[model samples]
Target chain A: MRTFSKHTPLEYAVLYGRFLSLYMRSKMQYKMDTLLTSAAVLIRECVTVVTLYLMLQKFSVINGWDLGQLLFMYSFVFLSYSLCILVFAGVRDFQGIVHQGEFDSYLTKPLNPLFQVISRRSDLMAMLGHGGLGLILFLYAFREAGVEATGMNVLKVVLVLIGGILIQGALLLVPASLTFWLTKSSQVQEVMFYQMRGFIAYPISIYPKIIQWLLTYLLPFAFVNYYPAHYFVGVGSGGDGLAYLTPVVGLVLFGLALLLWRTGINRYKSTGN
Target chain B: MPSICSSLTKFMGYVLSVNIGNMLFNVWTKVAPVLIVSFLAFHLVLPDQAYMIVLFLISLLLGYFVLYGFNLIVWLSAFWFHQTWSFMTIKNAVILLVSGATIPLWFMPAPLEKVFSYLPFKDVYFTPLSIFLGQVPADDIMLTYLTQIGGIAALHISLGSCGARRRRSLSFKEVSESANVQQTYPA
Candidate 1:
């Protein structure tokens, strides 16, 4: 939770809810700006979707999955990424935070530094646009994939989404946290966030084996969308059981990322006294 | 000549003082995507064609200028509208889609392909990719490059000059403001 201090998880949730309300209050004051920016985000996302539609029109299927299945995978990825962006907007701008000597303020507070970093800002506009569109696409693709709207199926989808957010958050943070040592790591973050994750929106299988191996073993982005979608859509290379391992992998990776973050903080060189 | 030499030295000094490691990382992020895509193209989709490679290389050279000009325009737009981040996202999305980074131009609808052909967006990515995939005929390559050169010239002179003018005005404003403050405060 964003406000996790010495409080219980429930208390953290309540405090985070209050922070959410505060953020919303400030954000809602700029209705037109929010509306326009949200529309911008929506249009940017639609461009990708439209491109995918065009490609599918040319070739009915890519790597074995049809457009419907690809959309389902992409939707999951989009939903998770938007959730991470909303919750961890602070981490995304870690370079700015470090440069502006804002990290010191977090250190002085009696809160988890990571929580403080993450909960400082919430991108409501991105969440509304990216998440709303992603959800719609997910449902449309779900029906196309003939995934029954059963309660268990819904629960699995929810879990996969959570796993996705965790994985994406960890990946975003790992590069960002390097700012502690590197001093300026926005470029590194951009490489991961923009290039690597952008490629993940499509099926990783289409890539050569080396890339597939890199995404699976080194980066571990495959678990974020591909593996889970495999379990749901039944359209991937073997290890159906690995699909269920999404949450476990997410949790483990998040833990490792936290460890890396803590280590980076220890190595942090403050701007000035 | 003396002024140009002094300014060049000053620019070099500034560049040297800036963290080279960070600069390299930034450059790498830009270049690495092209490398990855090239790797994918070579290994997965298309085999190496000798003539196509020559065309691809030339297109890439032209694309460097075209993309750099476009980036400069976008960067300069930030001076006018501080909220150019979203603008950048939209711009990149449109470029990626129209330039055949997302879908090869040959596969696009005929009308759509024709529309994009008239724009410089295809010159950025599609021209090179299409060349590498042997989609472009050798006969048309000369005309394509000529068109690209015209575009490169227009963009470089127009947006490029505009950016230089903006920078000069901004520096003049800063100098005047600082002088005024010094006069008032007597620092």
Candidate 2:
């Protein structure tokens, strides 16, 4: 595998943007498929929303949370997800790339293979979904909670949320990078995603001490959604010590993923297809 | 050449038969939609038959329609998920929020409920579960039911056509490539 060549930062940015545009065009090649998939996906996501709505139908408050706060958490979760999809659209095919011997091309490129892989598919549709969900979340917060929409607050929350998304997207590489060593289709990445969705969506305060500790201290999903989100909701700060630690922490984890990836690359036996 | 072709045909058809059988029977039956329908019918309609069977049936129909759409989604997603095994968290969040397997939506925060209402997960449980309880309004619920049932049928035909074509294209490419390799040296 060849190392990515250094380029002027502006030139690299333009190149990356061009790649993104091409990807969007490629995805559009299957216009009907894309539309149907988007509709189907929208319907699928709607099902989840319906379930939560009905639960509220039975009772007014969940664990003392009003509708607005829950919306904040819920929106953040989906919003973070949208960000992950938008940023990491192509990462899902890590194993397939390995199988097809597609990874060989990255070694011959001048840029980081990981960046190339992540940016390969620009999921504009998914990004739109994320934006749609976020809009709904904010709108509801404004209407129900009587919170005034402010530029500063929006900036703070969105910026922090983007940071959260970055961590989540980068974290995806950990399991994806695993494909480097295993070579076969890897499910570890899927398992971890399930973990994030199942455990991280709810308020972690309800969890047992050990499990909460695991999500909070060990995996750091707590920080991804529950912690920094508090600041966004104006419920409270992330806390004194590391309330705002998620962004840096996500970067650190991403760094480790890269290290593991670098180590795994040595073990990669490319068919060079 | 004829003998080789006939035997290969028989062999391939046999493999295809087993696969088709499993897909139609085992996989389809085990999905959440079928289970939801059966359970709703048994628990709501059977138990309440003495009082209001019509209401129960209406409720069951609504629920079944909603779940049917969801099943189609599962069917589609199963392929992507199994193939890629990416985005496990999103799937998990989706199942929990949509399915109502965990927390009931009524107890969730108001803003949360608003978003949840649109999500298909809650729809999976709400239409059937609520209708059985006489919670959903008759007129609106009917619209919901029609959409799901109609959507399922449409989705199935579309996805089947698309998937089949892609597979055929792949095989066609393989055939042409192999033939080209043979022609190059005139073996």
Candidate 3:
């Protein structure tokens, strides 16, 4: 029954555009609240950067990476995370959808359930907050780290940004898909995704070898920022070679996440109200 | 009256259980392995004085109370603001930075460190960790303990005042409705 979506790609895009506009308008209805919340998010994110700056002021460098290189690497995590949430807020909140019996409504629709989920809501405040900071950091650190951007390098950065977004989205999707069996996966997602992502904000090499291995093999959050930063900044010790594999890792992980999502959907039993 | 006391007891019991569970998890996952390895490698040096351990434990207990009071205030703010996620997130971020959970306070600029020293956030993490590491000088130990106790008392007093204000502003109809719901639920 869930073999194919009847809607074409163009139709899906149009529907998604409508969803985006609707979400934006609804959010805009309360301008003050939106502004305050966005500002709060911005300040919350800046706290980590401030902490990093303070630490760097004392030590000058950590794991042989200076403040500029560190920020350059860290900016990718925020940029990709903001964009990922923009597109995949629905997936992130899938537990709520399932728990509220909204998944039943999606199943009834002619559109793909995943598409419906993907286009349901966009966190514009978070996007603005994180994206604004990320852009500032990237611009400042790009020059500070002395990464001369030719057209080719700019294109590569864009590709890496897309890959990073996919990897982060997949990270959210995998835990969300577990809500089908677990009924509640937010805590798992919290520890697995958010808590683990904190490790990558600094160089993972600074951490214990066990934690480094956990981030590398068990979670692969390193591929999100650390390895890609290596590609651009060329400073980290090992995994310089793995820098080229960012997009590949992202694509593979995303594909696996989709497979998990499909399996979850197939097994889904709506909570009958 | 008995029911109210029992409910309070239950609430405290739940909080204590959760805190113990978290403590055990942290000790097992984070502390135990390193301690065992250090002992096996003969690289671990026990503190010369037993009072240091006692002081550290006292600091830890005070730290917990300080944090609980701080979080209670934040949780109570929900009565005024219907949505508290932003407040909680901002609070967590502030605590993470000021408490030296992310970076040690000594790493901070002198002026900024002075400012944070005035805040209660440092008592939650920085004080306990510093005490454990034996970084708090013997002369300052009593002073640190006084500050931690003072912070807890200040927080509790503020919480009490907030509760009193909430009670005064609460309408009879709202109270009756809540009481009725509670009676019906019989929790």
Candidate 4:
């Protein structure tokens, strides 16, 4: 097997693709299962969007943001979240690895531990479910909001989305890596990935000042969708410059998470030993 | 390929195969967390009307059974389709929407509200919530109770019959796969 550490960026990408495809082929052995799972994803996403639409119909707006703008924000949040799940789902199951002492196996290999853990599993059904649907909704909402479809603006949206995914992936990794010390960090993972993550589905402004502050500074989830979305819609108090910080914040958070992960690695005590 | 009805049937079949204690334990395992959280949260808020609180408790009790009955069916679908994770996600999303966990039914658009009224999902969360918020008037209380019962009855009977059919038709491979149930409710 080729060693992972010396690979260039292009080579790394090819290796990751190979790992993902191998997993995909294994999953696709159950064709009906894959199709049903994809359908379930599609249905779930549609229902969530519909719930938002119905709520929008009642009040016509939430916290001064219109439906079209809300949809744009919503779609972006979904897109980034789904991408995180697609790319870094193995982190979601990191607890199992630690419990089973599989972490040692990754370390034994010549590959980068993080890459091996990340590319170990890929839920492509979720990618097709949320990514495809989210893109369509984002475009439709973009048109409804009357935003000009210039190339630069589109690039900005795409980049911000990538940033958002990174932020979410960091959130997953940070709590998950804690399993090295905590042994069972599923509760922490649930709070970060599920409960806290839900707050991003709506405008952060509707929440009280304390929650807004927590999301902004403590958790930094505001940079995920709220700040960038506010920038796109040209609403909210701070200057448009804050919007540019999203991708930067994403990169910083991910770097911090990696640092935490390294610290956890140093502290790791294999379950068997 | 697993229609809701067929899945429900299969789940009911599994339910019949399991012992009564085990079945209740299974439901409790799924429900205890929510109950504990709600119990703690209930102390945080003091309702103005005692009668409304009483009505809320009653409606909530009924809602628990109704919700769990539906949830049980959904959980049992895993026996047939190991890919029920996505299906469970979809079911919860739909329940959140139609059951008024996301937004109260009153705040919902008229057409959506009308549609939800016909579906049994409202009894799962919405009806009880409306009672707690004191949104449900006294006259409408009976109607809601009747609806909740109707929903529960429909699910209970369907599960029973479907489970009976599934227990008879299950192959040896399926029996081995569902070892958890077989250990409890022996053939």
The candidate scoring highest on lDDT is: 3
lDDT of 3 by residue, B1-187 (tens): 4544455435434544655676688899978998899899767866678889899989988998898777666655655653445555677778999999999899988998999999999999999989888899999999999999999999989988876677534333332222222111000
Per-residue lDDT tens digits for candidate 1, residues B1-187, read: 4554455435323422343444467569767887788787766465366767777889887876686567556545645544344555567778888888878887899999899889888888888777787777879889888877887888878875776666533332222222222111000
TM-score of 4: 0.84
DockQ of each: 0.26, 0.11, 0.32, 0.39
Tell me the docking grade of candidate 3. acceptable
TM-score of each candidate's B chain against the true B chain: 0.66, 0.45, 0.70, 0.66
Q: After superposition, how far is residue A111 of candidate 1 from its true place, in Å?
A: 2.2
Per-candidate Cα lDDT values, in order, are 0.75, 0.59, 0.81, 0.77
Candidate 3, residue A75: the lDDT equals 93
lDDT of 4 at B88: 58
Off by over 4 Å in 3: A2-4, A22-35, A208-218, A239-241, B1-46, B169-187
Candidate 4 chain A, run of 10 with poorest lDDT: A234-243
Error of 4 at B187 (Å): 36
Name the runs in model 1 displaced over 4 angstroms.
A1-37, A187-194, A208-214, B1-65, B68-76, B128-139, B149-187
Error of 1 at B35 (Å): 5.6
Whichever of 1 and 3 has more TM-score, that candidate is: 3
Worst 10 residues of 2 chain A by lDDT: A234-243
Ranking by lDDT: 3, 4, 1, 2
Candidate 3 chain A has its poorest 10 consecutive residues by lDDT at A30-39
